[model samples]
Target: MADRDFLLWPFLETRHRDWAEEVEAWAAANAARLSEGDTDEAVRNLTRAMGEAGLLRMAVPESGRLDVRSLCIARETLARHSGLADFAFAMAGLGTGSVTLFGDPALREAWLPAARAGTSLAAFALSEPEAGSDVAALSTTATRESDGHWRIDGSKTWISNGGIAATYAVFARTGEAPGARGLTAFLVPAGTPGLTIAERIEVSAPHPLATLRFEGVRVPDAHRLGAPGEGFKVAMATLDVFRATVGAAALGFARHALDLTVARASGRQLFGGPLFDQQMTQAAIAESAVDVETSALLVYRAAWLKDSGAPRVSREASMAKLHATEAAQRVADRCVQIHGGHGVVRDHPAEKLYREVRALRVYEGASEVQRIIIARAERARAEEAARCKPTP
Candidate 1:
């Protein structure tokens, strides 16, 4: 089993600790079935099961106040058990985050409950073919009609939970300003008059992902997530809230990889003795252990800061995501190495983890993007410190 010592850390409260154990128990009990069937079926089943277990409720809290620590705990625990399970839970929270944070009462009432129950799936439709990393480059347009409705046109790609989601929080250009300032967010339901699934994307690690097209799709004014031209704000705010949890997910994957590595090394025979007898094997395990612990520190630090009400956790969140994802990749590589031939065989846990841990580095802000955010934040902080130098 993965280590439970982190639950006792000061970063978590009693309730969070208890919640972590609860999720852990649930995940352990359901591990055998989480990856069953094809990707689409697995995700659907996982969502319903998680909802029935009351775990998905944490993703869409009733209090309208997101507890980042709780989110991180859930992601870490779920991810440790199954990557697809983590994906299912994270997308549900992220897809509706804009509505949860900024939607009017009617919109929230219409969406949050169903999402919390997992009876309906949700998608965050932000990226476009040309706007993957750069939000400002988004080309999707949502033109307002004279009758207080909006006509959405264009497409979104790389959308998680795309084809199967019951609703999507789609970002588009409303021409309120220019670049990122002119964006707007909308809640478009599946089976809308003009929304179509353009393509299904197959990835190394299977999950429900698709490219979507919207041609003259009309949504009522009530479905607008925030005020017009505030789409950028809504999208960024949602990502800021969810980014640290990405790191927590990476932490889970890394921890599980380390566990597998240790187990493999302790049992396998090498050079007429246990593989753990080799200094090289021991060294790899030691490095992975360090990576796992350090990743936990960064991930929870960001989560704790957010839960404690830091106005924006961009810097901390980016740092956590960058370090933990990169660290997890390294740890997974070592895990495969320690497992030797068994690691590369199809369906092996180490091989599956190698594939699963890879995408975390790319999504939720790539490591390169996280570095840029961190550097810019640091530069701004330094400039502010210098400006306040007591007039000396």
Candidate 2:
């Protein structure tokens, strides 16, 4: 069973606690079946199941308001049971996040309901083969046509829910301004005239990733998200809301590792005693506990700040992602060490966790990128504070 104590923290309200409990119950019952067999089919089935349970509705709230805490709780709880299930749920929010935040009523009516219903899968297409973190360097171009449509030309790689997504929120260079300012987001429905699945990307922990090619795929002007030259802002705003939940997912993985470690240590016998009897084993478990709690605090702090209406939380969110992902990696490593050869064996709980915990540190901004974001934000804050100091 997953840890429920974290939900009692002051960062969460009563409603958040109740929602966490409900999600945990549902995930426990469904995660295993949703996780079985072929990866692609499992993800597709899980997507529909999550929608049927009304969990996907939380991603697009009634008033079109996004509650960051709810997202964090959902990801954390779902991740504790199945990483693939959590990925499906996260993409549902992330893929259509721009529409929820910036799309017009028509776009929302067209996509959001289908996404929430699991009738149509959604994907966010921003990263390209050459441009991953450098949003300004994206070469995907969307040229305005004489017919009041936009013709997109370029390829996007590493797209989540890639081939199966019903629609993609794609970013492209419109040349409306310069660099990042020139980019714009467009809603590209699957099976469009010139769109193709370029290649399927299989990773260590896979859940439907692919490279997409757009050879003059034209979309109606009505499909554009937000104003022209505002794609960067739209993407950032959406990421800012969901990034903290990435940390929550990491926290869940770490907690699961710790639980497995405890069981292994208590039940295994060595030298006429339990494996946990050794001081070294006890110290390792202690460190794992500290790491788990620390990660939880950071994750919830960012989530609470976002929920409380903070305009910008790049620094907090970066810190949370950086610390939680790194800490979870450490916790998983320690659990593997404790499990010895069994940890290295495939299909073992610890072994599976070892692979699942890796991508979090790299995606959603690498650990190095998060450090840069935090340092830059701190330096700016310090400079502002220095400027306001009165001279004696």
TM-score, one value per model: 0.99, 0.98
In model 1, where is the ten-residue run with the lowest total lDDT? 31-40
Worst 10 residues of 2 by lDDT: 58-67
- How does candidate 2 score on lDDT? 0.91
Tens digit per residue, CA lDDT, model 2, 286-344: 99999989998998999899889999999999999999999999989988998999999
Q: Model 1 clash pairs?
A: none
**What TM-score, to 2 decimals, does candidate 2 have?**
0.98
Cα RMSD for candidates in order: 0.9, 0.9
Across 89-170, the per-residue lDDT of candidate 1 in tens digits comes to 9988998888899889888998899899888899999999989889999999999999999999999998999999999999
User: Which regions of candidate 1 deviate over 4 angstroms?
Assistant: none
lDDT of each: 0.92, 0.91
